[model samples]
Target: MPEPNKDEWEQIAKDYDEKWNYLHCIGALDSKHVQIRCPAGAGSLYYNYKGIYAIVLLALVAANYKFTLVDVGAYGKNSDGGTFERSEMGKRFESNKYAVPKDKELLPAMEIPYVIIADEAFPLKAYLMHPYSKAAITSDEEKVYNCRHSRARRTVENAFRILAGRWRIFLKPIETKPEIADLIVLASTCLHNMLRNTSTNISLFEGQIRMESEHIHGVANLEPIRRNFVREVAITRDKLKKYFVSDYGSASCPWQWHSIRKSRVAPRRVQYYLLNTRIRYNRPF
Candidate 1:
């Protein structure tokens, strides 16, 4: 995938803010496991916690559900964090190679770095935001923050859903060598983006999108591993957490309070219910 220039990055961040209500978010990051038949002599290298032989499809998706970048063929045994850290995109991010727009104000005087929203599996950094640990969440503000964060991050999840739904090959274990499977995945993602760009009537596939969204598929609820983060990074998260509940911040969503309360009672059920609600209303959460 080609890297987005500074102007394109700014546009992505703007789209994310308008649609997902997450300020300065340029993309959503996630990984999906593509199952494959165990290759010759590749014993446990591709074995994952799910008891399947697979490869990791690490992706960074834009607000429109188009893949901005992807890294395929990582060992499935590795966690998303490790896979991303080793990816070419990750290395570029580490070296600040991408022409990302500089930090800007979310509110009048409070500036925050442009960030990518990920789940708990990824580390929190100055330029990346992950949810607060479930055990560490002591305030409603944190809950609100996580709710919005999940909403924004769902773009990547939905992108993967569309990819798998459209390409039936991903529904079953790819019967091929690891090298061929990698090429298949890469080509599919490229085509997926192209189709998304060219397709005129998205409503033609609404049923498939809804069906895929309703199912609780391969998501693994692993406990978030602790890692040492810089004080500035921690403070960055806290600022955004507070902003989600602040009256002055445009990121606050009125429905989040009700959603968070329902989540406290039944997390999974509320998630499923809210997802349907969004699909039905055809609007953001």
Candidate 2:
């Protein structure tokens, strides 16, 4: 492969690699489905991830260490992991997206790469991997593979924490012109990167207040996002080594945060209902 040029390759290297220095044998990946009020005369073509009509924001994060952002792909309704893979970053990074260059020195190589954490809903691709199912493999091995993938992939969950944690914009349903949705997403990401780069020295509590005020939502009080982040982290760490082996069927992926909604009929049922749901938690790319 040719040597990296300072302008182009250096930016790519920074965006793809050094930013994720904390990650190990894991990559954080997930998707966030945001509600966008549909346009007039449009059917439910944008309806997705959930029964409701909305656009889904697909994101990737670095897991295996400190939580960090990798990349994000935005799409309309009816999009799944397969659908989001149509994004430029997804096509470029996914092992199955294109021919894998034999030259290991390519960007995919220079870093310490690993698995991606995903829920049962996502289909498994080679580099963007998942766990074995009871029907697909022995239960014992399935749990083993799952636990390994979970550990490294939780970073994306944490990245979502940083997002909803700071930008309350994601806390509610967002509505805009279909074409403008991607731009809003890009703006959120730009702010995220900007804040992430600005060094901070405030105390924990002070910092918490600052973020809450800035993002406009007290996400720390949002029990579901908080709980899922913790729950997924635990699931990812148990018996992890087994999933890391090459001979085994396990794989890795670019990671992101997943946003899921919970439905309830009553006030009491609302809190409990939202908390018990398995279907939605922020999943990343």
Candidate 3:
């Protein structure tokens, strides 16, 4: 058998990015889980809140909603923020060698932000942009930034929603090893990107994107354990009204996520996972 080379993977990443171009924007970053086939020795730790071996896929979606950098994976037990910390992208940035695409003259390479926007599950490091906690800053500027940021960050969640609805691979829990699980995810992402290129193909975003003037990406489900520990989870119905309405979900978050619970719904019962976070937005974090 022949060994795969770096160029092959790089091509995959490029093609993936092209597949996710929603409206000329490239690369939406979000973490998602794929249920595994189950490992013999893997403990409950491998089971995510989604009740599967959910590996963290740190991918970049294009403007058209095609995935580009479906290049790296992290343990399912890790949060988006934690996954980012240990990802190859993190190492590249830390070494200050993160590279931008400069191969095409027509699509000339532009040095955009090294990082992308994420939800409350992610920490507010220099590389990532998350919303502000409601208590962190109550100023008007903060409010405006939050609004704009949420708009941009919406892409991640939107992407995820589209993915789940279309693929349904993630709708169920996985039971495979972390590495093989990563391949399953990669194949799905690659398929998503390939189909995104042709408008004739029906995808998850088929009706969803048309509804909004500006399409945004979607976020993946959070671990049940980290839910209550996230400040955003701590917000009451009233706070949510104020916060989400004020675009608090967009800009200025050091917020925590609320853990998911087993409602009468079967999906709810299956959701159970946790990870140590870099930034704890609330107590017991």
Each candidate: RMSD to true structure? 6.7, 12.7, 13.8
| lDDT agreement with native, every candidate | 0.83, 0.45, 0.49
Error of 1 at 212 (Å): 9.7
Show model 3 residue runs off by greater than 4 Å: 1-27, 49-52, 71-73, 101-115, 175-178, 201-205, 212-285
TM-score for candidate 2, residues paired by index: 0.53
Off by over 4 Å in 2: 1-26, 64-76, 94-117, 134-142, 201-285
By lDDT, the best candidate is 1
Candidate 1: the clashing residue pairs are none
**Reference-based TM-score of each model:** 0.85, 0.53, 0.57
Please give the lDDT score for candidate 3.
0.49
Candidate 2 C-alpha lDDT tens digits along 54-142:
66666655321223333333445644556546766566666443322221222222322233446545545434455444344444444
Candidate 1, residue 205: the lDDT equals 60
Cα error, residue 56 of model 3, in Å, equals 2.1
Off by over 4 Å in 1: 203-224, 250-252, 266-285
When 1 and 2 are scored with lDDT, the better candidate is 1
User: Which residue window of length 10 is worst by lDDT in model 3?
Assistant: 256-265
